[model samples]
Target: MNNKKENIRLLVSLGIAGVMVAGILFIVGRFSSSISKNAMYDPPSPLLPNSPFPEGVSLGAKILVTADKTADKEAGVQAFASNDFATAVTKFQSSLQSNRNDPESLIYLNNAKIAKSQVLKVAVIAPIGLTLNEAKELLRGVAQAQDEVNNSGGIKGLPLAIQIASVDKFDKIKELDDQFVKDSSLVAVVGFGRDEKIYNDKGLVRISPGSPTTQSRQDQTQSGQTRYVFYASPDRDNFTQAIAEYIVKKERRTNVAICLDSAQAERSQAIKKQYADFIAKAGGKVTDTECNLSAQNFRASDFITKAITDGAEALLLNPRPDKIDAAIDVARENKGRLALFGSQQMYGEKLLKFGQGDVKGIVLPVPWHQNANNNAGGNNSFGDKAIKLWGGQVSPRTAIAYDAMQVIIAGLKEGITRQSLQKALSNPNFSATGATGKIQFSPSGQRQGGVFLVKVEPCESSQSCSSSTGYNFVLVQ
Candidate 1:
């Protein structure tokens, strides 16, 4: 009888302890709820069904409910706010007990998943026959920007990865084209504006970092259109028109002459016709056209002699800066008494240095640079980050490269599949500090911004030339 009584007493004590423990747990749970509410700035009211998830779905809830909670919720929130997606993802995952249906957990989890898959792979294929040092530098800038973004906590915590494949300029055309076709992961292509047939693939989209010929080609579906290509730079038509207008409007000259070196006269003729129209719209005239650019003794004097003989008051040419030396020789031979105008091809520092007397009055349309203005439009935070991580040299292609990586990262965060990257690139809605300007695209694969007109100035006697206003280019307002 004494043993039975002792067993009963033990059972009674155990029941009382259990009740007391339950009471204490209930009070602690309420206290935790209050702290969570205060921390999140929660109001004492229920949310509407259409509103954002309740406070219960916040990181605080996950932290308080977890057995090994350790103030991870606040850290996760901070990470997310700073675009440090990777860190936020780690913290959120740590605070979750069962993240399956938790809205906040799911949001972070989805971002992490997309980021993991968004290891964007790109391949650059320049025209095999052209010597494109500028294009190479631009593409390199883009690659370096990707590296920087990847290192800085990545997009939504996914790392950025890029690969480049360059073809020798002397390689066979067929072999070069074959190489581009074989690589399947190539999300987009750059520096192939000269060859429409190379990038005419449905699965891939091409981004032209340089100016393609303005002359229309049969490969494209329509005039001034790139069927399978997205020109990060302005289309040849817009660029040429802008150049022609600058000569007439800014330089105060008329009677323009066109010097054509392209193979087919079709594109040149089209450009001439369009340029004449734009000039007329802007109130100007075209005096003549020169079909041959490789005439014997094509000296500055020869062209000027022809221009003076033809009553050419203003010359609109397309010779690159490297070729300006020969043109300058021709001009000096002719006594340097002629007004000249050229395309963006003649706006480099070399042209300003070597052809100062020959190209004094020359006008050309070029991309505007912010650095010319106390570095206002410089690659601010994104650009600085890219330069610091990559190297000391930040080229013009830096902005687009960073923007491209951001696009890839964003798509990955939003669960954009590989199949849709091409489409997304066709018309990405996000705004980013572009290398050129506010970088955005249109549905037809053209950059949706205007070009700028720049003037070349005489620097010194055969030294590297600088801009008159240090690239202080303004819109045609």
Candidate 2:
């Protein structure tokens, strides 16, 4: 009887302890100054049934300060709030040196290190004379990310800055590169077509050693400086491969018609080669067509008519944003029978503004989408904040560019130096969460997350798209 009584007493004590622990965690969740999150944030599945390939990466907001701040933690937080990441780092370090196991101290110390680092200043370059919406959208993402980070204690405490410039002449790439190189603050350039114009036969690259190939450029330097500028968009080879694979294996569309944007002939041609190579290897037929970007009212009826005659089941457009509408118009001109595919370059608001009821079943490989499946969207706190800040529709450019900036910010937290930044980028093993998905890079500096396919069609209301934003971007496999 005594032994039974002791067992009952032990059980009661254990149950009480469990309740206390839960209560502590609940309070922490509610009151932590900065809710700390791991590197990647993935929305709970089922809740995100709309996402096709839902296992991409996303950024999670985490706690940087604790409610029960120790003396050291309090001092560090004060310093952090004042933008003195250096002093905060010092205090955090002292606190850690005193108590090796203090969690808040360790966390604050990390925050201090990141905040004390150099500010990341990425250069945004576009064709001279205008603020290309894509570039502006990208900058907006960067700006939004910067504001969020700085407001939330920044990357340990350092904020991000951006510089916008124009490339008036392709031939003047060397001159432009030289001017950029003189500014040590400039770490990466987001635009600039990766064509020979920037690296002609004369080896016009100003960073020295020009380049060998996209595969080897990020690792090599000329005169101890970076030879390659990181690109924000998807790689040409990988992009074509993803689109081709989707059509061949998933969509099962065998006969494809290729349309090229004449204004972007060089880039389009490169992508076309990848498409042709993939299609041929897959034992599929591909027909080629050309479109012009300058045409105000583009109707590629000739191209569509010829493609249909050739038994092409799908039309793949390698065109600028202006041409996407034209491509859609021509497809509609054919009564919307053929499946349409495009690359990331095919982003525009007009698809919704005009092509709503007519443009359906159009598939494209984009790096980012306002996936309702993501925890950040679907009227979630992050998604609501994004809509309120940027207004209108959220373009893919904005999402990817914002994530790219986040990637650089994450890299700065590790160790702030050009070499550190480069290694973090060039290291294939390195990965982090962006607004879209998990982002990593290959040794060649190409981003490593798998491509996601979004299609336009009839859809119901969700956090990202509704009648207000026109059609929805359904994530198809």
Candidate with top TM-score is: 2
Give all TM-scores, in the order shown.
0.60, 0.61
lDDT of 2 at 173: 48
lDDT of 2 at 119: 52
Residue 442, candidate 1: Cα error in Å is 2.6
Off-target runs (Cα >4 Å) in candidate 2 are: 1-120, 126-131, 155-157, 166-176, 193-228, 232-234, 263-267, 288-299, 376-385, 391-393, 459-469
lDDT per residue as tens, model 2, 386-458? 6665444466766766666666777667755544555566566777676666766544445555567888876
Candidate of highest lDDT? 2
- Candidate 1, backbone clash total: 5
Candidate 1 similarity to native, TM-score: 0.60
Candidate 1's residue-wise lDDT over 1-477, tens digit each? 999999999999999999999999999999987554222221111211122322222211222123222455557656654556688778767754433212234333333333435344454443212433333445445555454555577545544433333343434434544554444434444445344565553334556665445432233436443345655666666777787777777767666666654444666576678778877777778766353455554444455667667776666666543355555554455453556656665544445445555555556665544243225544555445444544333434444444444445444444333335454565457444555556666655566666666554444556432244223112233
Off by over 4 Å in 1: 1-119, 126-132, 155-158, 167-174, 193-202, 211-228, 289-291, 295-297, 320-336, 371-417, 428-432, 458-477
